[model samples]
Target chain A: MKIHENCEILSLYIDGRLDPSLKKEVDVHLLSCAECREITDRMKAAGKMLSSLEPLTAPPCLEKDVMDSLESRRSFSFIRMAPAAALFMLLVILVSYSLILPGKRNEKLTSGQNLLENEGTPPAVSGDGLPGAGSLKAPEGTSAKATTEEEERLVSGRNLMARIDNDDIKAELKDRPADRVPAASSAPALKVEEMKRCETEQGVREPEERVGMDAAGKKERPDTGASSTREKMGDMKVENRESEERMLPYISSPSKSKAALPEAEPALAGTKESGSPSPLVISNRKDFTMLWNLQNASGGLTCKLPDIDFNRQMVIAIPSNAGKTGYYIVDTVEKEDGIVVQYREMPIRDPAPTPYQIRVVNRKPGVELQKVE
Target chain B: MEKKALFEGIVREEKDKVFNLAYRLCGDFHQAHDITQETFMRAYGSFERFEGRSQLFTYLYRIACNVWKNSLRKKSFSSFTSYRLDDREIDPPAREPSPYESMRSEDRCRMVQKCLDSLPARERAIIVLRDIEGRTYEEIASILGCRLGTVKSRLARARKSLSEKVLPFMEVAGK
Candidate 1:
C-alpha cells in the first residue's frame, strides 16, 4: 500500500480497530515506511495522554441539587402549567381591552368637530343614529297606539338608566366644556317658557295655537307660505340634515350648567314651515311640564330643562328609536332669541319607548345616583 | 419495580458516567455539573418514552452532549471565537503552588484537552467517547447512532488531529 493510504490505517491500528488482514498489511508497511511508523507512535501517545486525564468526581452536593430540583418540580410543574398561565393572561388582556375601547370611542366622538358633526343625532348610539328614520319628521299621528308605544319605550329606557349610572356620562363630558349651555340665563319652567320662546321667535303663531294638528287641517301661516319661507326653510332643513349625518345627540348634566353649549342647533325653527307635518316638538320647561308643538315638522326639537339647584338634578329619559333611548340632563343656556334649554344626552344601554319620564332627584355633589331597583 | 424506583435506580447507576462525559466535553466542573443536571432532568422527563433500544448510559451520554451544545449556542460565541480553541482552561488557576507531579499531570491533561477542544464538536465528542472514556468501537457506534464504518473513520480523523496538536508538545518535553 502507498504511504499515504497506510497513514489512514495507522489510527485504527492504534485503536486496535483494524481488521486482521488490514492490520497485517499496515504492520508490514509500518516496518518499511518511517512516516507511517511515526504516525502510529504519535496517535498512540495522544490516546495515552487523553486516557491519563483524571476523572473528576462530581461534587457531592450534585445529587442533592438534582434530587431537590426534581422534588420541587413536582410541586411547580412549569411545563404542565405554562399553557394555563398564558390563557389567563390572554383573558385579562381581552377584558381590559374591551372595557377601555368603548370609553375611547366615546372620547373620540366628542373630539373637535365630532361634537358639531353628531349634533341632534341620538347621543350614545354609534354611527348613523336612528336607522331608517332619516330626515323624516315626527309622526303627526299621536295616535293612542303611538303614545302607548312611546310610553313602553320610556319604561325600557328608564330601566336602562338605572343600570348605567351617570358616572360614565360625567367622565365623557369632562372634556366637553364648550358644549355645555350655561343654565343661569336660559333655565325656565318647561311648558310656559318654551311656548313664550316659540311665540317670540316665529312671531307668526300665537301661543294659543295648540298642538294636535293633523296633516290636512294643518294651518300654513300666510306669510310663511311664501316661496321664500319654503326656500329658506328647505335650506335650514338641508343644513340640519347634514349635521345630523354624524349625530350622537349627547346631552350634558345640569351640573355642567357653567359649560358653554356647543353651537349645534338643528335649525328646528328654520326647518319649520307652518303648514308642514313636522315632529312634535316637546319643549320641556323649568317646572317639568312639556310643551308639544305638533306643527313643527323638523327632525329635532329643543327643550329648556329647569335650573336644577346644586343639590338637585334632573334625568330626562326619552325613547330615541326602536332599540335605544337618550337620557338628557337638563342644562340650560340663553341665546339672543331666548333661553335655549339644552339637554346633554347620557348614553343609553338599550332601546326603549317614548314619553321618557322626568325624575328630579335630590343628590348631593359626589353622592352616587340612587339605584332604582 | 415501579417506574419511579426504576428511574431512580438508573439515575444512580449512570450519573457518574454522564457527569464524566460532560466534564470532558466542556472542561469546567461547575458547567459540567449543570450539564449533567440538565441531562438527567431531560432523561427523567422522557423516561417513559425510553424503549431501551440502546444502553441507558449511552442514551444519557447523548443527552449530555446535546445539552452541552445548546449551552454553547446560548453563549453566542462569535464564529471566530468558537473556531479559536483553548480559550477555556481545563483547570482554574491554582490557589497555591502545587507539587511538581500533580502540576505535570494537570499540564498534560490541559494540553490533551486543548487539542480536543480545537476539534469540531462532533469530532471532539468522538475522541472523548472513544479515547478518554475507553468505549469500544461498537459501543460508540450505538451511542453516536452512526454506522460502525462511520465511527471508525471519524475516530481515525479525530485521533490524527489530536496527535498533530499534542505530539509537538510531547516532542519538546522529551528534548
Candidate 2:
C-alpha cells in the first residue's frame, strides 16, 4: 500500500487488527514515509490523552430515581386503563339488558297467543256473542236498529263481566242455576234485556257462564222441569270452573306457561265430551319406541311425537275417536289409585278416525281417562 | 419481579461506564448525566427486545450512543456551538489531586475535551468508544451497528480529526 492508503490502515495497525503480512507491509511503508509516520505518532498521542481522562462516577441517587420513575409509569398506566375497563363493563351490561328485554317481550306475545287460542274466538267478540254470532240472522220481532242496540249492550256487558273475577260469578251461578238467563236464545231482545239486568244486579257474570246457560237452555227447552236444566248447568259450571283453574296458573306465570304450552295445546283445542278409552301411558323409551313403531306401521301420526326426557316425563296418548276430531283435557287430577284425566271432545263436521292426541306429563305410576260430559 | 431485579442490577453495574462514555462523547458532565438516565430509561422501556446475543453492558452502551446522537440533533447549531462544559457541575475524582498537579492536569483535561467536542458526533463517538472507552474494534462495530471494516475506516478518520485538533495542545504541553 502507498503512503496515503497506509494512513487509514495505521488505525487498524495501532489497534492490532491487521494480519502479520499486512502489518509488515504497513510497518515497511511507515519507515520510508515521514508524513505517515508523523500522522501515526500524532494519532497515538491523541488516543493516550483521551484514555487518560478519568471516568465519571454516577450520582448516588440515580438507581432510586430510575426505579421511582418506572414505578410511577406503571401506576399511571393502570390509571389510564380505568376508562377502558369501565367502558367494557358498561358494554357487558348493555348487551345483557338487550338480551333480556327481547325474552320478556317474547313471553308476553306468547301469553297473548295462548289467551286467544284458549278463548277460541277473537278478543272483540268472545264473551256473550253466539259461537258464530257475526253470521247469525237477527230474530223475528226485532227491528234492525233495536238489534244493533242490543248487540252494543251485550258487548258493553261483556267488557264489564271480564273486569270481575270468574270465581264470584261462578258462585252466583251455582246458587241460582234455575234463575240463569239464556244469552244464546232465538229471541235476541230477551237475551240482551236479561244480560242488562244481570249486569245491574251483580256487576256481571262471566261470559263462559252465559254461554253454558244458553247451551243448557237449548237442550232443555222441551222439558218443563228446571231440575234437569239445573243438573246440566251444574255439570257445565263444574267443568268450566275446572278449566278456569287449569288456565289460571298459566296466565299468572308466563315463563312456566310457555314451557307447559305444548302439553296444554291439544287439550285446549276441543271442548265436547267423547266416550273414547283412557290414554295409554308410555313411561319408558322402550314402550315409546314400540308405540312409535306401531304408529309408523299403522300409518304416520297426524302430529309429531313430543320430544321429552323419558326419565323425568311420560307421554299420555289419548285414543282417537271416530266421532270426534280433537280432544281437550278438561282437568288432570292425581289420585292415590291413578291419575284421572277428564277430557272433552270437539265435534267434527265429518266424523272420521283421527290421530291420538298426545299430552306430555310428569311421570305418574298409573293414569285413568274420564270423559267430561 | 425477577426481570426488574435483573434490570436494577444492570443499572447499578453499567451506570458508570455508560455515564463516562456519554461524558467523553458530549464533553459535558450534566448532559452526560441526562444522557445516561435517558439511555437506561430507553433500555428499560424496550427490555423485551434485548435478545441477549451480546452482553447487557454492550447493549446499554449502544443505547447511550444513540441517546447522545439524538440530543445533538434536537439542539440548534448555534446553541451547540455556544455550549460550554461547566466545571462546577463535574464530580471530583475518587482520589484528591495534589495541589501542584491539579491545575496542569485540569487544563490538559479541559483542552482535550474541547478538541473532542469540535469533531462531528459520529467521529467523536468513534474516538470515545475506541480510544477513550477502550472498546475493541469488533465491540465498537457491534455498539455502533456497523461492519468491522466500517468501524476501522471510521475510527481511522475519527483519530485523524482528533489528532489535528489536539496537535497544538500536545505541542504546547511538550514545550
Candidate 3:
C-alpha cells in the first residue's frame, strides 16, 4: 500500500510497530528525504511539548461539592417520601377515626356517589336547613330497612346543615396560613430539604460518613420503626368528621317563639347554633375551589366534589335561619347559577309536621314554617 | 457504539482505568476525580439507552473524551478568537491563588497552558491523548471511536498546529 502523508504508519514507525521490512523502508526513507526528516523532527518536538504541558492541580475539598450534588442533594428524597408520609398519616387518621368515633361522612360520600352512580339521576336531594340530612326522596328504589332509610336521611340532613360547617372546617383548616411560607409549598419543601442535605454533606465530613448519614437519615425519616405519620393521618380524619358534624343542619329555627319540634332534633346539637349558604350563582370550579378555601378548613382537607348529581328545585327546610337574610343559596352545581329559593316565610321558631324538609310549605302566622324535610 | 455491553463490560472492568486516564488528562487531582465521577454518572445515566455494537472500553472512552472536551468549552476557551480577546484585551480578573506551584517548569507549564487553552478542546484533546500520553492508534481510535485513518490525520494535524503555536518559547533539545 502506498503510504499517505498523514498515514499513521509514521506513528507506527516511531513506536517501531511496523513489520521489519516496513521499518527498513521507513528508515531508508528517513535518510533520503529531508522533508520526511523534518516531519519526524516536528513529530518528536510536538510529543515533547505536549508531555511538557503543565498539569493543573485541584484545590483541596473540590470533590465535596460533586459528592454533595450526588448524594442527598437531589429531589429523590421529597418526591419519593414526604407525600408518602402525608398520605400515610391521612390513611391512619381515617382508619382510627372509624374505630373511635363513628361518623357518616364516608357513608354520605358513598351515598352521594351512589346517587351519582347507581341512582341513574335521582331527584334533587337538598339539605338546606335541618339537623339530620332531610334528604327527601321517593326512596329512590333503595329497599333499606326503615332504620337505614331513616339513618341516611338524617345523615344527609346533617351534611347539608353542616354544609356551611364544611366551609367552616375549610376556613379552620386554612387558618394555619402556612401557605405563605415557602417551606410549606410541596416542591419548595423538597428543594429546601435537598439544599439542607447538600449543606450537611458538603460540610467537612468524610465522603463515606456523609453517605452513611444520608442513608441513615433516609431510612430513619421515611421508614424507621416510628410510623407516626399514619397516626397523625388518623387524627386528621377524626377532626374532619368532627368538622362535618359542625356543618350539619340542626337548629329548629332562628327566632325563639316556636319550640323546636321533637322530630327535627339532630342528636349532636342539644342546644343549637346554626349557619347558611347564599343563593348566588357560582360560575364554575373556581367558585367551588373558593368554597373549599375556608377559614377553619384545616388538617389536610381533601374533597371528592359532588358531580352535583341532579339539578332540580327543592325547598330545603331551614331549621335555624341563623344567617344574614340576603344570603341566598348559590348553585355551585353545574357551575354557579343564581336561583331564587321561593319559600313562604312565616317567621316562627317551633318545628312542626315532617320536622324539617326542603319544599314549598304552607304556614300558620307567628309559627316559622320551614321547607318541610 | 455497542452501548450496553460496552458500558457493562467497561463499568465492570475498567472504571478505574478510564478514571486514571481522565485524572492524568486533566492534570488536576480533584478535577480528575470529578471527571471520573461525572463520566461514570453519565455512563450510568445513559446506560439504559446503550445499544451494543462496539467495544465497551471504546464506548466509555468516547464519552470520557467528550466530557473533558466539554469542560474546556465551559471555560469560554472555545476558539482562538476568544483566546485573543481574553489574552490581548481582557486582563484575567483577579483570581484566588492556588497552593501547588513549586517549580519554574510549573510556571512554564502554566504559560503553555495558556497556549493550550487557546486551542479548541477537540484539538488539544487529540494532541494530548495521541502525542504526549502516547496512546496507540488502535487505543486512541478505540477511545475516540474514529476510523484509523481519521485518527492518523487528526494526530498529524493536531501536532503540526500545536507545534507552530508552542514552539517559540521552549528550548528544544537537539536530537
Give the number of the best model, judged by TM-score: 2
Over the full model, what C-alpha lDDT does candidate 3 score relative to the true structure?
A: 0.39
Which of the predicted structures, 1 or 3, would earn the higher DockQ when compared with the native? 1
User: What is the Cα-based lDDT of residue B140 in candidate 2?
Assistant: 89
- Candidate 2 Cα misplacement greater than 4 A, ranges: A79-90, A100-373, B74-92
lDDT of 3 by residue, A160-252 (tens): 111121222222222211111111100010012222233234341224312322222222121112124223333444545443333211110
| Model 2, residue pairs in steric clash | A272-A345
| TM-score, model 3 to reference | 0.39
Model 1 residue B61 lDDT? Answer: 82
Which is the winner by TM-score between candidate 1 and candidate 2?
Answer: 2
**Rank by DockQ, descending?**
2, 1, 3
For candidate 2, the docking band is medium
Residue B85, model 3, lDDT:
14
Q: Residue-wise lDDT of candidate 1 within A124-160, one digit each (tens)?
A: 2212222111111122212111233333333233121
Candidate 1 lDDT at A18 equals 71
Interface Cα root-mean-square deviation for all models: 3.1, 1.4, 6.4
DockQ, Cα level, model 3: 0.14
| Candidate 1 chain B minimal-lDDT segment of 10 residues | B77-86
